[model samples]
Target: MRKSELDTPCILVDRVKLLDNIRRYQGYADAAGIALRPHAKTHKTPEIARLQVEAGAVGVTVAKLGEAEAMADGGIRDIVVAYPIVGSAKLARLIALARRAKITVACDGIDAAASLSEAALQSGLVIDVWVEVDPGYGRAGVLPGADLDRLASALVPLQGIRVCGALVFAGHSYGAETDAEREAIARNEAGTALLAAEALRGFGFPIESVSAGSTPVGRFASAMAGVTEIRPGTYVFGDVMMVKAAALAIEQCALTVLVTVVSRPAADRAVIDAGTKVFTMDGEDSAIGTGRGYVVGHPAIEVAWFNEEHGILKLPDGERGLRVGDRLEIVPAHCCAVVNMLDELHVLDGDRVGATWRIAARGKVK
Candidate 1:
């Protein structure tokens, strides 16, 4: 098959570019002497996860138990659910997943840890856990200090829980305006997590791994001292936000939403069949650029807004090059959200269809 045969408003992944992304990040981690365990939440495709593993990813990181279940079912041997698992329903799945994969869960609070410990004990299996440390992002994870030690204390006494180490998500790096700023965020993330891990170790907890990752701060963050693993998901398919953040060149973007022009409403505006549903509204602060999404190679065009199924492309003054039936390639603001929105990615190697890989963990919000 070919690109022309695919339907509009679908994801197109350039296989060459995809493979390039995998190898590039893997090579970086190898050189940095850290394990590369890509976050599977970014792609959600087990096939792509296999490719990542083949490229030397030590394991896969997921944000939920459903995703871990899917990856483990797909034969990926190791995974880490990077989010706190709460409630009996989710814990049941988490414990089940632990039987199939080398599972590790992250949590910053003792309450969640208690639930996990109970579940692990009920399942009669030992569970490894990482004390999530907030690297000043203030989203999840305990701050690096006494708070982390408190959580570590709660887990250390649990018969079923093993304190592995610490994990930090350098999400704030996305807000950085320059490479130097990103590197600084990465360095801070590593240092912050290390401080908590060392503190935990002081209490006699075995701190075997110090995990960290963010696409914008990929190599810079992983190269930080004491970081044992790097989990990067967006690097599998670079997005417009990454390009705007100077994380990758526009040419390196492998995933794009292929949409067709449906209306040329006026000289200054046009409409495309894809909308927010196709290209989600996720942004990385300034990394989203000036438009809802960047029209690839069309700097003069801006997807100014999107309805449920209509994308309004605002054209530059006196520039109406697009016609009603023409197709456009859209670089989304967030590649991970785009993957979740689609059922399968139309794999392509420059205009020719390679194969379609189903998003194995789509809608696995649990």
Candidate 2:
């Protein structure tokens, strides 16, 4: 079967590009002497995660416990739950997962560590955890120096939980407009994580892993000293946002939405069968242009507007060539979000349908 024969508004992944992307990033990690624990949130497919492991990734990282459970069920043994594990119910689940795999969770406070310790002790398991450091995102991590020191001091007495290292998500690099800015963000991420690790070691804590970087700064952070591992989720499937950030070329985008032009309302307007439901509300960088996605073959055309189920295209001047039933490929602004909206991905071998892979962890937010 061909892409054209598939239903409208479906996701397609180029198998060749997918494997090439995995090998490319793995090669970078290997050359930089850093371990690659790719965040599995991008595809949420265990098959892809296994591919990364086969390509030399030390393990896989996940944003949620449910995602970790999914990967573990799929036969992955080394897993990092990048989010802080909280609550008695969730802790029970975390301990259960630890029984089957090597689980390293992220913690931001002494209270979280204490809870993890209690749960692990109850289950007769020791859980490895990383202290999360904020890399300018003001998200879910403590700052380096005093903030980190305080947390470490309080955590030292905790039982059944050992602080292994510091985890940094330099997600702020996603907003960088140039290569220099990305490099700076990467340096800051590396510096912040290294500072935290050094401070912890000064406090007599055995620090081993310094996991840092997002896809935007993976290359820079991986090459920096003291960072033992990097977690880049979106490198496996490039998107328009990565293109805008200058981290990936459009051709490197392995995932694309296949949609059919259902209506041509005017000379310069046409509508496709994909919209916010297919491609999330995530938009491209405004400085570069305005669109939720990039038209694969039509540069001038823009996804001018969108509704819940339809995308309005502003056709290029003098081009009324888009007719009903015409199909087009779109690179979404955020591949991770786009993928989470789907239940399965139709993988393409060249232009023909190759196989279908279930998004094993789709909507696994627990």
User: What overall lDDT goes with each candidate model?
Assistant: 0.84, 0.87
Candidate 1, residue 318: lDDT: 52
lDDT for predicted candidate 2 compared with the true structure: 0.87
| Per-model RMSD to reference | 1.6, 1.4
- For model 1, where is the 10-residue window of minimal lDDT? 281-290
TM-score of each: 0.96, 0.97
Model 1 regions lying over 4 Å from their true place = 221-223, 284-290, 317-319
Candidate 2 wrongly placed segments (more than 4 Å): 283-290
lDDT of 2 by residue, 1-366 (tens): 987789978899999999988988887788889999999999999999999999999999999999999999998999999998889889988988999999999999888899899988888888998999997898899987788888888988888988888898877788887888888888878888999899888877789999997888876754567789999989899998888877678888899999999998899899999888988787563234546677887877777778999899888775578899999998888899989898999999988999999999999999
Q: Which candidate tops TM-score?
A: 2
